[model samples]
Target: MINLDGALYPWRFRLVIAVLLGMVGVIAWRIVDLHVFDHDFLKAHGDARSVRHIPIPAHRGLITDRNGEPLAVSTPVITLWGNPKELMRQRQQWPALAAALGQDAEVLSRRLQQNAGREFLYLARGLTPEQGDAVLAHKIPGVYSLEEFRRFYPAGEVTAHMVGFTDIDDQGREGVELAFEQWLAGVPGQREVLKDRRGRLIKDVGVARNAKPGRELALSIDLRLQYLAHRELRNALVENKAKAGSLVILDVQTGEVLAMVNHPTYNPNNKRNLQPQAMRNRALIDVFEPGSTVKPISMLAALQSGRWQPTDTVEVYPHSLRIGRFTIRDVSRGGGPVLDLAGILIRSSNVGISKIAFDIGGESIYRVMQQVGLGQDTGLGFPGEQVGNLPNHRKWPQAETATLSYGYGLSVTAMQLVHAYATIANNGRMVPLSLARVDQPANSTQVVPEEVAKTVQGMLQQVVEAPGGAHRAQVPGYHVAGKSGTARKTSAGSKGYQQNAYRSLFAGFGPASAPRLAAVVVIDEPGGEGYYGGLVSAPVFSKVMAGALRLMNIAPDNLPPPLPEQQQAGALPGNGGRG
Candidate 1:
């Protein structure tokens, strides 16, 4: 009986061993199916359901003045981001996370629920360091901060037009920023990371892309001059009770813009309260009739073409002359039949200038105007610059020609007129106006002959020093040459001047022996006392020019002679004769 039972037991043990071997084979086959045979399928599933890292923006470039003073810059900021997949996984901790971040738990829950399994989403942007650090310190799964940059204007309203401001994402919106966005903005960088089951960053295994920063811009503007111009213009705006004002200072030789300022300017820093009109750059964007400031250019054209001499006298039809349907009048009703070109300019005689323009022919005068950069952009690269209107021969009505001769009927920008005046100040050499510091080509074109420029400068100085000339422009210690402009602003859509609305302008350069700074100042509708360019704008020009000369250490040319009051009254008025 024992022998038979033992044989049965041995057979049963052998059967058990065979069954275990079969089960092992099946397990190995299943492992091979999942790990190797279905590798592609598993990889696709993992790719579709994984934590992905997005890119963060790089720092922007610096905007500095010629002296390396920072005009515009950027500071690091933070933005909150979320991984909906992880946020949903840790739904139990939502209350604590939302409380610390000032987010409603129920709202966050709905947001996460709605975006279930989403890889990435934005929470908030432009957060402060402390605020961002508090949220990041919570260590909530899927919630993180992205480092970024926000634009900062160091000089505030002082450099608003030059440095410009950027949008929230660091894109340029205006000024130099808008003009050179591509060069100033940089590419963003990215990284891919593997997270643990808890959504904690494990290790960075691969780089998605490289980051590039913006290129720095170095402008030709001098910060000192910019501040000076801004201060003066602001004071003028307040003192004169003006609608607006603009001032520009240029280097006569290089035509580089030392300073360009517009009053009623808004600060680029806190733009929350800015108005549309306050941010406008009036110098380049606005146009006005230039009046007698244009007289010098007309006279220059006459001398250039041998049409008239600075000394040549023209009979100025008494007080007024009718040109076609319009009557041309002078500032003063002179009891004179004849007046020299010098006398005409000195007296700011509208009728005398009309005769000169008639003799030179409108075509020649218009050609000279074009050559001198009138009725066009000066190529300064400023944004929103308007190319002002210049009526052609076919468009010029009978009254147009005469009115244009005295700086009406045609429109010009302050910068264009200043640039044209600078060409004469630079002794006929017309260099393009530059706001950025790039070397010009070796060969520069000449706009007028040297003698022609000299002749014009001489005539302009006489206009300031002449008797019965518009006064208040005399500087104590320099020989200044320029023209005064007092013209009425034309009504919109109408061909007539606006009553009591005048543009007062003074354009000049000193010390006259060798011009350094060619400056222009314009006041819109200055009231009280007098509004003529000689009375209103010239005093400002003298004050600024004197300061500029002192700052640059430019030696005085002819220190103004002592006043007759200071000394014995010798020469009677108008007896100084022609300069």
Candidate 2:
């Protein structure tokens, strides 16, 4: 007590007291500001850590055939996602999580490290509902799932080229899917959701938008006919060892494509081993010389120009006609000295047709072909429909004109050839083809006189009815009129033609008295015993047409009577002439 008074000064004591009071005042102001003035900002920060804006996926549209049979549909699936930072924090759980996901733990760890800065990552996609539930039941931290729709094609490879397919993110990639994507993919919605620390959704706060489901699409394809065409084309491809093939069937009266199929197809559902070549729609995309198939059209042009008549006869002696430096020969050697229009088509005489083309000039032939939809689109609006090449005839030489008359020096698609044949079946009226059903019958323009069409039809009938015609294309209960074609394939990237490669084609209409269906079959590079259109492609036409006619319940007009025993005992005419 005696030293305490000397140890302290009055000014120094007052200064120390003032410093303590200042410190206390500052602490009080800071406490009030944190608890009241900035309270809303602090609360918002806390909420941001747990709240999320989640997506609500909308269901895609259903795709159906003309009869309302489902071709493509969507099914609900789950996709598992995770927060990389949180997922990596649980190192012990990595092995278990990887096991559930069918992944290796070391790979999973590496993936997490690669995505360290990412808040969300896909753990797995396209999981079934049951599988998703099993994964969630494990209560793994940072793992969550979202509901999504996956496309399912019921027809598989049967309708692969027509229906096409979607991608993992539900976007259309090919075929009709890619063509009508906007009309099929719907709008997605959003919602505010509260998430737990492990990224699991706890509760939905409120809706931000409502999802609008896509509208259903109905195609003009008849599933039954599609199946029939697909089966026949596949069988022919396998039997003939063909590199590829396509078949198109059209309703003659309405110009609607009843069926379209291509070979070298793939299952759109399983895309693990899908190749780009397998996805091509050969019927509309591939172009080939029509070969002798154009003879009917050329004959029609001659008939239209009034320069030729059905009863007109042309001498085909030596079975070959010389044009400049080129020679056009008939497939039947030493058979025709003089042939009427009927016999010319029945024999598929190159010389007879070339002589006619020389008389009418190339402009008339080109006009007739153009009117029949050659060198033009089919108006199907398919993704890759090609408008084939048709050269101008103004500068044509005799040889070029001759070749053009018999379907060379020009190209046409399978669909275009089918359209031309359908025009003939529709009594010379050109109707626009459709891939979707029309409420009313399409308008038709008269491309050829009715009399000319009738005459051509009768002449074509002789092709199947005559003793040495396309007998393989004959339907037992009906009269079939068709032309067979065998054109050597032009070598790609070269000027000359391939020695062995050929495109076997058949184009025809059925029920001569009252035609209804027009079909075309194309077998590319058949490598088997036969490669001619009559030998390799006509049989396909006969079988498919028989099924199609019976399916549609068309009346039989030319059912053959039972042959006499003596005639039946003789060998049937071989399908070896012309084509």
Candidate 3:
């Protein structure tokens, strides 16, 4: 029955066959276009949707002290980011996301809306690994985390001013961080990565650029000494109720800054409440009149002029010297009516020192001070270092000269004072100061004659060892040489000085026989019962020097003899009168 071959096929059947064949041809054409002719273009288009070029962050360098202890380091952290458009689409989940991110919902919403057009917006800059993990565990869409670094100061405020700190973006903002930003910041790399629709990383396609890590930096600061200085200075500040203070320790031979500390320092790691004043490196920035500490320098000038000998005597009867409407009085009441050269320094007699300065002339004293690196930067290359104010010798009147001899009419930084004392310790050669480790000893220029330095150092030893000298400055077993200074704080605009405010200063070196360390301690505006440098600052020197000498293994030169009956009964030497 089906044998009717050649019977005409239905029109519907033919139409159906033609339609099927056309569909096959179109499918074949599409396959060829996608897999052969336009493969690269189509693949690129697909990649553009799912693949991303992300930056690979490089780590910053480490800052270490001279002994290889880390002062500043970069620690890995996570930063949360979001695609504003994608995040907005999941607005209902915002409360949960904001809770996980520790942000207010309204604040998060406003921030997202403000940056709605941005493909990348930071939700939180620095986050702990646990925090980032907690956010990711929520599985909120469009939220992403990136690896980053946060600066950590291991020494905290102990070395804060010296090592400084970085900003959230890893840029150095202060201290050594700002000074060596170029060397500390590294280059970032780029890599192409494939991501899923939910913005989860799938696979790394390829690396475009390799990241370069920063180089390491080694500073000259000895952490042990730095800690010691910080502890002592902080204690002194608390005890004296001083407004602020600074302490600097220098290597007498090498000119390396072993320790530099400032009071009222802030923690660099947590700078949320950091004040501008707390961040200042007061040792190098703040300047003040050096007061009676400069007596030795004036004596040095007098001796160098061939006009005064170690045995020379001066009569400061009534303890006052009148010069051109200015009266210089001795702090000593009864014992300073007459004194020898060593007695003058031991007693800290302002009138006696003034008499010698008048004999030597102002130019000689100014010349000696200038030669000792006063009124100049200490060559530390620190940011905002002040050169201080030393008036020209030609501008000095007779009264000004008398004041200059007693360390008034001029200003000096704590660092400059340390440098000057270090020069004396180095036997008159002024070495360039450094904050970084140096391979070789720095070159020095002779400021004072070697004999003059030795003689002055000997006289300074008397200032610490004499019966009425700075007995507080004496280390238990080490011979110490230093001078104490107490100067009235000058008012901001007026020529007159503040009545009660004073700057207590002590400068000296330890192991006096062969000086190894020279240090300076300045307590600003001490509001305690005793404001004299000998009473306030000298004790700090004694403690710090004792520790430093022991740490350095320097042999002590003096051993105290057994105390007499009176001394054993709690009566210490140099406790009778003001220095």
Q: What lDDT score is found at residue 85 in candidate 3?
A: 84
Ranking by lDDT: 3, 2, 1
Per-model CA lDDT versus the true structure: 0.81, 0.89, 0.91
Total clashes in model 2, counting residue pairs 3 or more apart in sequence or in different chains = 0
The root-mean-square deviation over C-alpha atoms between each candidate and the true structure, in angstroms, is: 8.9, 8.4, 9.7
Top-lDDT candidate index: 3
Better of 1 and 2 by TM-score: 2
Per-residue lDDT of candidate 2, residues 1-579 (tens digit):
376642567777777888999999889888888788978777788789988888899988999998899999999999999888887788788888888888888888999989988889999999999988888888887898999999999999999998899999999989989989999999999988998786667898999888888889888888999999999988999999999999999999888888999999999999999999999999999999989999999999999999887889998888987766777888875445998888888888998898898899988899899999998877878898899998885576888888989999999999999999999988999888887776688899999889998889988888887888888999978888989999999989989899999999999989888999999999999999999899999999999999999999998877667889777666366534453
Find the candidate with the highest TM-score and give its number: 2
In terms of lDDT, the poorest run of 10 residues in model 2 is 570-579
Error of 2 at 442 (Å): 2.4
Using TM-score as the yardstick, the better of models 2 and 3 is 2
Clashes counted in candidate 3 amount to 0
lDDT of 3: 0.91
The digit string of per-residue lDDT tens for model 3 on 1-579 reads: 575333465776778888999999999999999899989988999998898989989989999999999998888899999999898899999999999988899999999999998889988978989989999999888898899999999999999999988889999888888888898898999999998876778998899899898889999889999999999999999999999999999999899999999989999988899899999999988989999999999988998999999998999788987876767788776564678999888888888888888787899999999999889867777888899998876555788788899999999999999999999988999999988887799789999999999999999998999898999999998899999999999999988898899999999998899999999999999988999999999999999999999988888788767788876765766676566
